[model samples]
Target: MHLNHSPNQNIILEHSSIHLAIKREDLIHPFISGNKFRKLKYNIQQAQSDNAFRLLTFGGAFSNHIAAVAYAGKEHGFKTIGVIRGEEIGFKPELNPTLLFAKSCGMQFKFVTREIYRTKTESNFMDSLKTEFGDFFLIPEGGTNDLAVKGCEEILEESDLIYDYMCCAVGTGGTISGLINASKAHQKILGFPALKGDFLQEDIRKFANQDNWELVTDYNFGGYGKIKPELVTFMNSFKDRHKIPLDPIYTGKMMFGIFDLIEKGFFPKDSKILAIHTGGLQGVSGVNDLLKRKNQPLINL
Candidate 1:
């Protein structure tokens, strides 16, 4: 799981307007399966370099990074701790299967309320967390720092594919920044925010630090972790169409938004674009459980 290989072309929809490289090797493994693997390589090495026994990080209830961090931490002989956002509702934080797997792989949990969790980026919070955890390496949430972006920037190297404009879902701005920075200086990047549109570009700009990145807030599907019937229909049809499973959280919305933009004549007539499928398969089980637990019908399409 920690190894690297050359890209296998999964040419799904190749028209005159687009040359999409849905890499076949990317689709066969666990979702958090590809990009996260690359992102964590440096972090794990950093921990070992520092001779740290534990790796600490932050994420939401359904964070793919937390799962990957745990999996990778265990793999590399480092203990993992997740300072998760939101308070534990029950003793377990309900322990969703995604988190449960992380925990099973030897991840510890430190739950905090949303209010306090917002300040996780503060030096003080990290200082105190370091004091508490005692000599552990702390990875920022979404792994969006210079290192993660530098690592993610290499995703393009595995492919001989190129795009005039690249489309990706912006969650923490790391992947978009990394990919945009990695691509040629002239290439354009369109980022669709998974969360609300408010100040999203401003948020992205903090990571991008350049002019080539554009934020498209049109197709968030009613905000982060929230979905609609049309989205489910689109996901199912897209799965059938491209045979790629897109969860509701990130990649799915970006794909939907890209099509909507194309419909509105946003891009040029023959724009070659690539849509990144950042893996997040662990999210599906929890989202489906969320629907069922709320008695909400999930398959409306």
Candidate 2:
């Protein structure tokens, strides 16, 4: 799909003498959008090549991966099984938009306790799932694997070489690893992790061939799925100003870091920047619910 590489006209960029453009990967597809689409592209092909009838993956109550894989599996004629993180969600799927959407797409769920879900990468867990669900293609939590990284490398095109910096939100590190591999020699890739940690650097290094990348670890609000009122306010104001909706889990935090860096003079003057908007807009409804319960300001969707 041909996506628009639109310039962001935020006044902050003007004041900082930085030129920023957003690669609208979010608009790639309504259901299978952004990095999820990239990450799943080759994995889906591989699953078909292996003659798999089912695609089994992992996720939490409000996971974007769960929703994407479910839709992708349904659209491509493969049955999907979501190994959901919380056992409670299995009985109350209707309460969460992400899970509800996946269920609507014909995904079966195997909700596990947080403890069992922690053993998801172990051989014993794999054996148990195999005994229960039969032969299936396994996509790891967040769908990060060799094939997924290979698919993500296609995210940056020749036209993107003009940019000096490539920026994106980091989740399981798959997207940034692909960006790091595909990045131009002169371009420095900066990742704003949505979760707190230095562990992602090592994970990203496993797939990344180039060393032109660094992770900005300060923007993760608290941790995964954790958000603050300031972040909510920024997201709403940013959408009102830029006409772009950013999900709090990833892109919103990345953009917040980018704008903060620009304001703090982190980038050299006259630098050209391209931010990859990896879509997770589907999780916004779920996030708003949490905000409502807390009596905090909700993100203006």
Candidate 3:
């Protein structure tokens, strides 16, 4: 609820005379946390308003969106169906924590091949899904519709106006768009995109009216769901110092970029920075599994 400051012991902050605090959106809900909660809030309302009996969405192997939607659907009395990207995942749900959690929350899986999944936004594919699943509320992948942006706009409050900079991890561009819309005129919003490319800038501009935002494209490591050993070490040490666990997919990359920028003197002296922790901790198990296979250090969850 409160804008809790992170006690970052990174020496660069002290040298740069910059202040950093984290708005812990992750603490908003146990299951439906952070930006996921914000993104889903209005979408759920819209679905209910339409008298929809079921909610159908899309996601990949270990998508936080899938997990959040499943839990939110079960808790709010809507049947959930996930049109998963990988067909192989259907056979080994138990091995994947995100999928397992979704299944436990009573989400039915319609695992499709990558080729079919690529047509998720096509009319014919959607028509086929409607034919098979019957009438349902459609939530796009990553839950970044206009309504989701509306919900995320509430992530920043008047109390947050004291900060000079507002930063968040960008997935489908919904959360940063909301932050850009809600941010004070004096504050500059920075987005650390979890995935690669300049394409998200266009997606964000579709919802964002303000021009006070820029995406920091350096800290993605490799891309979405990709992590390096150095990142794992930083995340583990950061948790040790701050007692706040960051997921590798989003918040961790954002924080890593924030610290690196601080070291590089990107922020002006005496500037206050507020970084949002958009919770995706559920995906850590899946990431750790990959790390194990690679014989790399796992995230200390």
What lDDT is obtained when candidate 3 is compared to the true structure? 0.90
Per residue, candidate 2 scores C-alpha lDDT tens digits across 106-207 of 999999999999999999999999999999999999999999999889888888898999999999999999999999799999999988878998899899
Q: After superposition, how far is residue 230 of candidate 2 from its true place, in Å?
A: 0.3
- Local distance difference test scores for all models: 0.74, 0.90, 0.90
Clashing residue pairs, backbone N/CA/C < 3 A, model 1: none
Question: Please, what is the TM-score per model?
Answer: 0.88, 0.96, 0.95
Candidate 2: C-alpha lDDT = 0.90
Query: Which candidate has the top score in TM-score?
Result: 2
Candidate with better lDDT, 1 vs 2: 2
Candidate 2 lDDT trough over 10 residues, lowest sum: 1-10
Model 2 TM-score is 0.96
lDDT of 1 by residue, 80-133 (tens): 999988786326765587778888889988989999999998989888888888
lDDT, candidate 3, 122-195, per-residue tens: 99999999999999999999999999999899888767888999899999999999999998789999999999
TM-score of 1: 0.88
